[model samples]
Target: MKKTLMRPVGLPESASHPVATPLMPSVVYASDTPDALDAQYEGRVAGYTYAREGHPNADVLARRIDALEGAEGGIVTGSGMAAVTAALMGLLRAGDHVLGGDQLYGRSLRLMRDDLPRLGIATSLADPTDVDAVAAALRPETRMVLIEVVSNPTLRIADLDGIAALCAERGILLAVDNTFTTPAAIRPMERGADIVIQSVTKLLAGHSDVTLGWVAARSPEDRKRMYDFAVTTGMTASPFDCWLAERGLMTFGLRFAQAQATAERLAARLADMPGVRRVLYPTREDHPDRARAQAVLRGQGGNMLSFEIEGGRAAANAFAAGAAGVAFAPTLGDVGTTLSHPASSSHRGLTSEARAAIGVTEGFFRVSVGLEDADALAATFEAGLAAARGA
Candidate 1:
């Protein structure tokens, strides 16, 4: 009963067809009849006229991810940022206002900070963890509220239910970036989110190989709106990328479980270590939002943890370099354990004041626990911490 929703649809019965969906790479379809092409343009029939508009493989992936996210329908995009831009651009006009959380991915924050204003859409950032602050930031022209389920780097858990209810009361659209806590951990749509955005490049794909994004709309109108905007804007995902993401989705359940378990163990171990200053993980007992995370994530702390090294940047660099098998990568959610520095990596574009406001200090380093053995990672951390102290 629990796994049915995530189960991939079986291949159709055929004697010659392969068991998996084939990649449709054709850029343009050949149609002799004008009526047929007209029907495709009119949305009366299901077909692909151009790769930039639609493809069979992308359609399958969208439906598969829609099933996972409990959405009415969805569309795939070229990248995560494309999905975000398309969703916001499709929904908002020149006069609309967007209320965004300060705890967001660096690029997403920058888009709202610098880009949205140039497009004539106004935006303001606030602490989404504070429901009152979000409510206070709302304006008469405010049309949307954007937030992350679990914030990047800091791992702060947003009050999704509370904020969703607030948006509903104010008749505002709630768009949730579910990249961190994917459908495996929390489905934002089920919690009253109007729209859900994900970077399939991260956990859903479960590998660093493919780059793709998706948007799932809870309502049919919203779904059609996003689909139409995607086609017109030409941000459609490549057929091959879509296929790879679906193949990767097959192991998402198992991969996410194992990774989350390892993360919980690593978070617990790091909290008591001598060279560690603090660990920010949702399910940890001492986390400020531990209770909220438990309620929202249904007791899952997710597959990531960020900790502060005692000696700041130098110690962080030394620990990462000294750790065996752990690479100092700029991204997260890799199948192998990897580390990233928020201040110098993801949040490097933000001002020092902006970075400090979000608690991303020079010492902060985030660890994305993979399928690595817990005991082995523990030993690596022990050695790395020693080096960090020495540094």
Candidate 2:
């Protein structure tokens, strides 16, 4: 009876395999003997002893992302920021310098400007849309250039081919954050980026339920270094989250296509709306980076767009209140349509001058379009614009 209670009856292996990836949530794995465990830890065999070191779910997700990005190797991390940190810390050393885009996400800007410096890594910001500006910012100590494929909120497109060529000429590594433009839109590796980072929490996960990220490297050595760093610092993702992300990935293509179509229709309608001061979307004729967007995203404006209201913060507030059909959330890449105020949320840490420099003004509202009917979404925006005019 004690033996039966201690070790429950084990089920025999099934003749057929599960259609879905099996979720293995065990933190500790067991082996038949200490010698076998030692062999597993020493990398003599293929197995997992600890979740932090490595896990099946993470491996599966990493491999899947690697294939998607055309990467030689990859690793999954606890969060998007963790993937960013791991990539930077793993490749760079003390006295190394990293040049990033000036229009990066606020938290990423803070991480480069504040955190990396504490570790003896110097950092600088440049306009990624212009390869000449990036070249001008490079220093003798510069080891890497990091840029988002598409800038957050503003929707400015990066010239990946130009920047990658510049980096290759200077012998500098180029790391691209592809969170906004998933592989569905563009693959940075194909354009000569050495490393591709994705916030799997966003479009890749699709449903907003998983907080995960991945780093895909062009070379096995780079991936090994990042994987070691992630393992050493306990930056690995939860098995359940990886599993959930994998599930979300299955429908990413359909979700992204629908959302992008809705965004295109809404961008056009908003541009003609009364209270709209400006509309920022890649496919729009008046977009600042229309040429670059054409070269990079291949005419896909993606599911995100931003517009400015005439009345600043007050109007933005009224618009949010009136847009009852879509929830006002601070984050992006959800299945349901949502609105975000960058001034109060993602870019709140930056000063007014800094925010204005990146075009994230008080009147700006970034929209994450979803699977809702296009006409219905346009009507919601009409209501929001009317509310903004009243303000």
Candidate 3:
């Protein structure tokens, strides 16, 4: 009994496997011989010897994401930012130039404009929706052009095919951040992106419970380089988080579809509502990049939308207070609907002038539509709008 207690009984192998992938949290695996251990380390065998190097949970999650993104290979990381860092660091060297979209997520923009320069990497920003503008911004040292499928806060859809063609001709890599669109809307890789990044913490996880991210590469060599960097830097994700993300992915398609449908309904409703100066949704007729959005998103407007309230900061505050059922969180992509103030949250790092230049005004609010009744959400927004007008 003591021996059994010390060494837990293992599950006997059976013909039938678990319906759910079993969580293997063991950080280290024992090998029968030194040669076997060496084989595992050298990638000669299909087994894991260390969690930091490669583990079952991370591998499983990576493979699942690769399939979703149509990637040749992928690597999961501790957080969305970690994945971004790994991708950039692995592919770039000192003196390399990166051209990023002007409308990228605030943190992403800061990473490129602020942090990367510290490493001797040069960076520039351009309008991703305008392929020619992006081309004009490119430098001779430019190695990567990073853009998002749907620009944050304003919903500017990128011209992926045009940019990809330009990049191919110039022999530059195109990295697309697909966290907003996910695989439900469109896979950027299919449109000629060399790399695709996802913050699995968002729609892919379908829950706000875990913080995870993944980088999918169109080539195995690129995948290996990023994977090596992630492992060496200890940016690997938790086994438990990967397992949870996998479970979330099971219903991702349904969740995303419902959320997107609801967003479409809300976008139209908000456009007609009082105290709303403007509504920015990919499918909206007035969206500046509507044509590009149609081509990239394939008819789905996606689950995210942004709007500017009539009264700016004070009105926005009042609206937040009045919107009783709806939550006001700084983050996006959850099972329940939530709102975020970009000027105060995501883009706070940027100067006021800079924020306004990108159209993130004082009254701007980004909404992450979730699996909720459309009418109920509309009612909540109505309340918020009334409050905004009063303020």
Candidate 4:
């Protein structure tokens, strides 16, 4: 049997008179040799071994995400929930305490609310808009404070640096999900975030075709523990998805820029239209976090913009159904503009009271700005609103 990797070129080579393996110069892609392993990585030898622990594709995606987020290193997971959950599981213990943002993705809210408690991990919710609320929720046992860079559905920006400073001073870790902002608009680590997580499912992949997630950190040491735990847990992402993620990142800067430009235009138009009761976008003048959004955001506020229709759920649904040029869909960050009702889609996992607490109402509609022609998308919404008003 050939060894996966043999050190010193002949360490105990009991391959006495065995078939000579062709000598190849040291190169990374040693996978051609069936026995080769990723030994060079762990100071063993130079070869490729397991795909789950390390694959060329996974490494490529990790490098791209790190480059995009400007992190020291990164780890990719099967889904967004896995990325966040892995970070927590790797960093926290049974007695650890967590402070969650008030405007959280509902599925994440459930994880904090139910799953963590059963593990003896305690969690408390805080208003991300209020620095005081975040600071007050911290406990001596607090291990990490997690928030979304831009709150979903509502599009509210969090005061990241302020909260990051508090975490740094208190010796706690701060993790931000940059899925909505997509690094091109806001690199949380640049503002003192300890970790930046991404759901490559949305914009990074640029298409709704792939589902993947990642956890990025500023230092290899910060990533070491998580990577170590990930291998044994058996929750690894597939190579195909990793390849799609890497390919998706190459065009991210361009896609993000284009989507954002159209989003700002849409937000401005929606804010002034009749039968539109509210436009919840970070850069809007009336947004509570407008000042912070301007301060930390690197580009036009990201591609998502949510608005409340005048009539209610029926009007919102009617408007969505009437949209022609733009696809009426539940997902975001695609090449074509897509629309959905957050109250029934993304935030549906939350109860009525919980949903209301986060400003998700029956009349709310969220559009993920895509690379579509802005005028065409605008006309589609215009026609929908006209139909809605008449109804």
Better of 3 and 4 by lDDT: 3
Candidate ranking under lDDT, highest first, comes to 2, 3, 1, 4
lDDT of 2 by residue, 1-391 (tens): 4554355346578999789899989898768899999888787988988899889999999888888888866889999999999899999999999999988877788899899999999999999888889999999999999999899889888888999999999999999999898898999989999999999999889888999989977877888899899899999799999999999988889999999999999999999989889999999999999988988898899999999988888888899999987989987788999899999999998889988988778899999998999889999989988998898
For model 2, the stretches where C-alpha displacement exceeds 4 angstroms are 1-9
Q: Against the true structure, candidate 4 has what lDDT?
A: 0.81
Considering only N, C-alpha and C atoms within 3 Å, which residue pairs clash in candidate 1? none
- Residue 380, candidate 3: Cα error in Å is 0.5
lDDT of 4 by residue, 1-391 (tens): 8768564443465657635222222223434443343345665664445566666667778887888788866998888888888788877889999999877777788899899999999999998877888998899999999999788778777878889999999999999988888888877888899888888888999788888889976667778878877767865777787776667777888998888888888888877778888898877889878888888785368889988887877787678777777787887888788888887887887788878877778888889999987777777888899888877
Clashing pairs in 3: none
Error of 3 at 265 (Å): 0.5
lDDT of each: 0.88, 0.90, 0.90, 0.81
Score candidate 1 by lDDT: 0.88
lDDT of 3: 0.90
* Candidate 1 per-residue C-alpha lDDT over 172-224 given as tens digits, one digit per residue, 9 for 90 to 100: 99999999898989999889999999998988887898889999877788878
Q: Taking the candidates one at a time, how many backbone clashes does each contain?
A: 0, 0, 0, 6
What TM-score number comes out for model 4?
0.87
What TM-score against the true fold does each predicted structure earn? 0.94, 0.96, 0.97, 0.87
TM-score, cand. 3 vs. native? 0.97
Model 1 misplaced stretches (Cα beyond 4 Å): 1-16
For model 1, how many clashes?
Answer: 0
lDDT-wise, the better of 1 and 3 is: 3
Query: After best superposition, candidate 1 residue 184: deviation in angstroms?
Result: 0.8
